[model samples]
Target: MDVLIVGAGPTGLTLGIDLARRGVDALVVERAEALFPGSRGKGIQPRTQEVFEDLGVLDAIRAAGGPYPVRAIWKDGERIGEQPMFEPVEADESAPYTEPLMVPQWRTQEVLYARLVELGGRVAFGHELTGLEQDAEGVSARFADGSAVRARYAVAADGGRSAVRRALGVAMTGETVDPSPFLVADLRMTGLDREYWHTFPRPDGTGLALCPLAGTDDFQLAGKFPEGTEFDLSLDGVRRLVAAYTHLDAEDVTELRWASDFRPRAALADRFRVGRVFLAGDAAHVHSPAGGQGLNTSVQDAYNLGWKLGAVLKDGAPEPLLDTYEEERRPNAAAMLGLSTGVHRGEVQRGKATVQLGLGYPESALSEDRRAAPAGVRAGDRAPDGRVDGVRLFDAFRGPHWTLLGAPAAAAGVHALPAAPKSYGPGVFLVRPDGYVGWAGDSAEGLGAYLARAGVR
Candidate 1:
C-alpha cells in the first residue's frame, strides 16, 4: 500500500477520502469496532466545511448538521438571557460558510467514511496498531490481532493517547489548560428546550452546558467538576451531574447514549515526522475543545498532508515534498493550540479566529508572489470563492488538480481557466490542489519554473 493511516476518526477518514480521490493506495485502520458514537468535536468550522465541499461530503454534512444556536443562560431554574454561541459573520462570495456548523462528530465521521468508500478507499475496523517500524523504503505496522501491513508511509491519527505516536518515540509536551475535570455525555432528555444551548454556571468556576445535538433528539451535556472530584460515567452519573448543576431532576436526563470524562489540555508533538512515519490529528496536537479547533485542525492536517503524499508517491515528486507537511502543519497546529487555549480561558471569543477562514501558508517554500506589489490575493493565501467569467472559483479549483486563474498559459500542466475573480484582484493565480494560491505573478513568465519546483508540472 501507499499509506497506512492509523485511527479512523475524522482525520484519518478525511485523509482516506483525499488519497482515494487521488487514486492513491491508502488504508485506514480503527482500533474500535465502529465509528465514534459521541458528539465530541461537534463544531465544524467554515474552512473545514470548504474542505468537505471539495471532498464531495458537504451536501451530506450540511444535511446532517445545523448552525450553532444561541446560548441560553439559566439561574435558579429561571431563564436569564440568551447570547450568540458564536460571533456571527456575514457570508460572502469569497467565503460561503461564514458560520460554523453544529453536527455530531459521529455523523461527520460517517459522512467522511462513506465518501472515502465511494472514492475506493477501505478502512479496517478493530485493527489496533501494536507496533510500527519504518525504514527508508517503507513502513510496517503490526496489529494486536496478529495482523500486519506494510506501506510506503504511515500516519498516526489515533488521537491524543495515540499508540502509533508512542511507538515512534515522539514526545508530546503540553500543560493542562484547566485543572477541572470535564464530563461530556450524549443523551436524550426531556424538559429542556432544544432551541438553545442551555448553560448553568456556578461561582466556583465550574459549569454545565447542554447543547442540543443537531439532526438527533439527543443533547450533549458537558459538565465541569470541582478540583479533585471523581465523576462517574454512567446513565445515573449523567443524571446526577445534570441535576446537581441545574434545576432539572435526575430523571430529566432520560437516556445516556455515550459519555466520557477528560481534563482539558493542550499538547503538541515534539516532532510531526519520524522518518517514514508521520503524526496527524490529535496524535500530533491535542487541543482543548474550546474554540472547536481540535477536530477542524486535525482534519486540515490530513488535508495538508494528503496532497504531498500523493505527489511523492504517485506524481513523481521529490521526497523533500513530504517535508513541507511538517514544516507547514506543525507551526499552524501550534498557533491553533494557542487559539484554543485562549478560547478556553475566555481570553478570546469564538469569532473570526474560531471560524478559521484566514489560515494560510504565506511562508511555505512552495508559495511565491513575484509581483513587485501584489494587488488582491498573494501566494500562500486561500484561493477565494467567486465567479471568474462563468466558472466558480471553487468549482474550478475542485478535484485533484491545480488551477490557474486569469492566465491562459498552456505550457504548464495546470488548467488555465477564465479571468480572475474580483476577490482575487488582478494577477495570475496558481492555486494548489488543496485550494491555496501557490504562485501569483503578473503573468505566466515564470509559472512553469515555479510549478517545476513544487513538482506539479
Candidate 2:
C-alpha cells in the first residue's frame, strides 16, 4: 500500500478519501469495531466545510447537520435572556461559509467513510496497532491480532491516546486548560424545547448545559464539576446530576445514547513526522472543545498532507516535498491550541479566527511570490471563491489537480483558468492541489521553476 492510516475517525477517513480520489493506494485501520458512537467534536467550522466540498461530501454533511442555535441562559427554573453563541460573520464572495454547523462527530465520520468507500477505499475495523517500525524506505505496523501491514508511509490518526504515536516514541507537551472535570453525553429527554441551547449557571463555578443536537432527536448534555470530583458517566448518575442542576426531573432524561468525561486540556506533538511515519489529527494535537478547533484542525492536517503524499507516490515528486507538512502544520496546530485554550478561558470570542477561513501558509518553502507589486491574494494564500471567464474558481479547483489562474502560456499538467478573477487583481497564480497558492508572478517568470520543484510537469 502507498499509505497505512492507523485510525478511522474523521482524520484517517478524510485522508483515505483524498488519497483514494488521487488514485493512491491507502488503507484506514481502526481499533474500534465501528465508527465513533458519540456527539463529541460536534462543530464543523466553515473552513472544514470547504474541505468536505472538495472531497464531495458537503451535500451529505449539510443534510446531516444544522447551524448552531442561540444560547438561552436559565436560572430558578425559568428561561432567561438569549445570547448568540458565536459572533456574527456574513457570507461573501470570498467566503461563502461564515458559520459553524452542528453535526455529531459520529455522523461526520459516517459521511466521510461513505465517501471513502465510494472512491474504492477500505477501512479495516478491529485492527489495533501494537507496534510500529520505520526504516529508510517504508513503515511496518504490527496489529494486536498478530497481523501486520507495510506501506511506503504511515499516518497516526488514532487520536489523543494514539497507540501509533506511543509506539513511535513521540512526546506530547501540553497543559491542563481546566482543572475541573467535565462530562458530555448524548441523550433523549423532555421538558426542554429544541430551539435554543439551555445553560444553567449556579453561584458556584459548576454549571450544566443541554444543547439540542441538530439533525437528530438528541440533546448533548455537558456539565462542569469541581476539581478532584470523581464524576459519574452512568445513565443514573447523569439523571441525578441533571435533576440537581435544573428544574427537570431525573426521568426527563429518557434515553442515554452515549456518555464520556474528561478535563479540558491542550497538547501538541513534539514532531509531526518521524521518517516514514507521520502523525495527523488528535494523535498530533489535543485541544479543549471550546472554539471547536480540534477536529477541524485534525482534518485540515490530513488535507495538507494528502496531496503532498499523492504527489510523491503517484506523480514522482521529490521526497523533500513531504517535509513541508511539519513546517506548515505544526505551527498552525500550536496557534490553534492557543486559540482553543483562549476560547475555553473566555479570553477570545468564537468569530473570524474560530471560523479558520483566514488560515494559510505564507512562509512555507513552497510559497514563492515573484510579483514586484503583490496585492490581493499572494503566494501561500487560499485561493478564494470567484468567477473567471464564467468558470467558478472553486469548480476549477474541485478535482485532484493543480489550478493555474492567469496563465500566459499552457502548463503541461495543470487546470488553467486563463482569466483572472477581478477580486484577485492582476497576476498569474498557481494554486496547489490543497487550494493554497504555491506560486504567484506577473507573467509566469518563476512559474516554471516552481512547478518543476512541485513535480508539476
Off by over 4 Å in 2: 408-410
Q: How do the residues 1-457 of candidate 2 rate in per-residue lDDT, one tens digit apiece? A: 9999999999999999999998999999999999999999999999999989999999999999999999999999998799999999999887888899999999999999999999999999999888889888899999989999999999999999999889989999999999999999999999999999999988887899999999999999988888787767788989999999999999999999999999998999999999998999999999999999999999999999999999999998899999999999999999999999999999999998899998999999999999989999998888899888778888889989998888754455698878778788778888888889988888977778788898877
RMSD of each: 1.0, 0.9
**Per-candidate local distance difference test:** 0.91, 0.92
| TM-score of model 2 (CA atoms) | 0.99
Q: How many backbone clashes does candidate 2 have?
A: 0
lDDT of 1: 0.91
Let me know the TM-score candidate 1 reaches against the reference structure: 0.98
lDDT of 1 at 164: 91
Per-residue error (Å), model 2, residue 266: 0.7
Writing each residue's lDDT as its tens digit, candidate 1 over 340-377 gives 99999999999887888899999998889998789889
